[model samples]
Target chain A: MAATTKGDAGRSDMPEAMGAGIRIVAWNVLSLAIALVIWQLASRAVGSPFFPAPMQIVDAFIQLATRGDTTGHSLWEHSWASIERVLVGFGLGVIFAVPLGLLMGLYPKLYAGTRAVIEPFRFIPPIAWIPLAIIFFSGLTRFAFLIFLGAFFPIFTSTLVGVARVEPIHRKVGIVHGASKLWILRHVVIPTVMPDIMAGMRVGLGTAWLTIVAAELAGGISTGLGRMMINYAELIMVPHVIVGMLLIGLIGFLMNEVLLLIERRLFRWRWQVSL
Target chain B: MHAPISLAKVDVDASHRYGPLTVHDGLKFSVAANEFICICGPSGCGKTTLLDMLAGILVPSSGHVHIDGTPANPKKHSISFVFQEPSTFPWLTVSENVATGLNIKGAPSDQVRSKVASIIDIVGLKGFEDYYPHQISGGMKQRVAIARAFATEADLILMDEPFVSLDQPTREHMQREVLDIWRHMKRTVIFVTHNLEEAVYLADRVLILSAKPARIVAELPIPLQHPRDPLSTEFTEIRSKCVQWLHASH
Candidate 1:
């Protein structure tokens, strides 16, 4: 029976398993629909100026995409602005954080000595730095600094943890193989900790988006999704507000999916294990 | 291809003054080329420590491990080692793991690939080349480890109970596979194990060591042919002698 099963699996004529793919997409769409239904019902029952029905929000989204009123900017324009800020800030954060994190991880004494200082700084929220950032930098740069601060700690901490957690046996294996210290770091240490780094990057991406929105709402930036959302809220254009929120959710989801796809492809070896 | 590896007047003395305990004291041995030597004893015999010294993973306090009449160096890829555990890199596929040493030496990509393919085939892991270490069974992972050691093209391969984790059948199968690979490759192997039958079956000569602060107690030659039958009279006689020697020591 096992041999026959293997034979069938090997046959190119047989169709690949499409069931798992269908199930995942169906589940996601169904959950989203359920959430929208609950949201719509709540909006109608409350009858509040704050909450708008799903259809009303959809109408607002359409207007923002086409008409571009109140904020006086199109949805695409705001999205591009937000995305650009995130990319710049995230790129800088990764550049600075990874090397520092690796150094800290490799040297225990350094990590120990700085723990007292790092702990308190890590707890300081990115939004709390908005006032200081504004005073420090002029316009978009201030917002970028906020995003960088938001993303930096998580990536740094996760990288440190990943490097520290590299199995001793793997290091021993490299040494036994006559790998130089640099070779060990480049091949064994880096690849071993990649899954953790990818996870950290995912978390950092979310934090970057959150900080971008918050920084824009702090009213320094002239153009951003958060600025548009706030402007629409003040004008009582409920649809544009909902549109902005939906756009944030959609973009965040897409970015996360992209990261996840990269993770899956790069670490296919990891996924082969059942556990 | 090269002169036999010889250890002359080798004395390893490692001691710590921790109130009243002396860990290691004055140990000596020499191994020849193409020698399938098995170092067997009860647990805590420092068999692993001896193997580590041979592989140059650890340095002896007062002696040297010479490979082809030269002192062994950890920085030199003169020796390959396989631990009892699955030491194949979890992040690399079977083929990639096997070719890692060659890649580290900056060998050409095509040569490394071809060597890896051949070794994989030799170890009966041809179809599982693309599988990661974790995807495979324990026995298969050990095979990958063996294949990796063979692919390194080192003159000496040191193994510490390479099949200790497998079931009896799988262990026997792996033992045979290892012998076959060794015969074809003609590399010197120093296998450390406690299993008497395994030692007699695989080794050209068995070096039995005493319990603690291990010293070589006896050296027995197994004049059995290749693909040794464990149920054969000669195999049983050697096995009983080893069992008797170990039990008699206690």
Candidate 2:
């Protein structure tokens, strides 16, 4: 009888927990639905080729995803191409940015001295460099450069901010405990700055996506989703364009979710309060 | 009592545009091995400055803070400190925080684990070892701080108003815990605080100081036993004497 009562209580608690999660998901879906409704109404009222209705967009999306060679390529092929460019460019940016950011963070004097040079370049839009990138690099490299430029600044700046704001008390504690400079940086400073770095990476990922689209349009990269999107626009095929847009949003959301999951797992100590 | 640490004719001075501020002017004192010495003074009277000097976090302009006949060096890690706020790393679990000193020293993993577990248990946080600083109550956080200090195995521990943030009841409870730990470990402690009752409750001797450009005004040795009743006559007498000395100096 006691075991049955305990099991009932456990079952009851599970629903409460699940209810909170469901509420969050429901709220997000409601907002998306409201946005779709607004889009549909606006499109119907205007009745222009540019603004398609939500159902029409959905129908287009299904056609593009299912039909091969909708815009001289399938949706899968286009998505694969876009993912390839973004992954390559973003990977290169991270390789360069992380170490540079760490150096800038660790050595404030060096960072301060170089700020005059780095800050102006950071403000220049990645798309603004399209002409110069074309002049410098050929083919895929030009698009990659634009993507790299787009992703670099946010990650670097966030890393610098994170490293700079490491609590003084934590450093003092490390000193009192006889930690060497390297040990303190690795054990205390790095861990404290990780969440900020992760936030920067998220922002960088968004920037990379935006820049890739512009790069693909400007440079005429033959295989990417961006090229596919432009080609669909040129052909007045609204469905293919909608499909590409949806895929971009979905992929970005999935990437962020993956990072969040990793963050939660690796830094469980940070989120112990919620548990 | 055998003098384990001593300062003689110690002079610390700082000069600004507004003349000079003297922190310790010919300050002379001796602390016996395993003694609980609480230094009490008004705010800005350099009680913390004095503790910092002793801990070797600061260099006195003109004097030396000697530990076991050598100048105190913070880099040596001979003196462990518990600050006004619990200084446990927010990113680390209680056990990891406690084991940090050992980790820095590059002790073997098994030794660090066993020592941390024992210290956590000693601090009455057996089950909460896996908990992070934010997950624990303030009192529990302070307990973890205390456990970390104890676990460091440093012969001399310095504390700067460690219980100043706690409620009165919790503070009193922490005072007892500190005394109990001191009794069992027999480690020399130098505690600095602004609270008269706390100074009386914890110290073998209380050193009262004057206001800024501070100097030691009076040193009162409490002839009380462990687990002292605050209501007792001796406790009241010493407490009043320390308060009076503080007022007179100001």
Off by over 4 Å in 1: A1-17, A41-50, A272-275, B1-22, B248-250
Across B1-250, the per-residue lDDT of candidate 1 in tens digits comes to 2233432222233322223433345656666777788988878777767767776677766556666665666576457788887678888888898998777777899989889998888888877776677667888888888887778777778889988899998988888888888877777888899898899999999978777766667889999898889899999999999888887644
lDDT of 2 by residue, A192-233 (tens): 888877788888989999998888777445677778878888
**Candidate 1 displacement at residue B69 in angstroms:** 3.7
Report the alpha-carbon TM-score of model 2 versus the true structure. Answer: 0.87
TM-score of each: 0.90, 0.87
For every prediction, compared with the true complex, DockQ reads: 0.46, 0.33
Q: Let me know the DockQ for model 2.
A: 0.33
Score chain A of model 2 by TM-score against the reference chain A.
Answer: 0.84
- The true-versus-predicted C-alpha distance at residue B138 of model 1, in Å, is 1.0
Tens-digit lDDT track of model 1 for A1-275: 11113222223322443555778889999998999999989999999977889888878778878987564777888999899889889888889888888889888799999899888989999999988988889766887788888889988999999998877767766777687989888888888778777888889999999999988888866688999989988988877877888899889989988888888778866642111
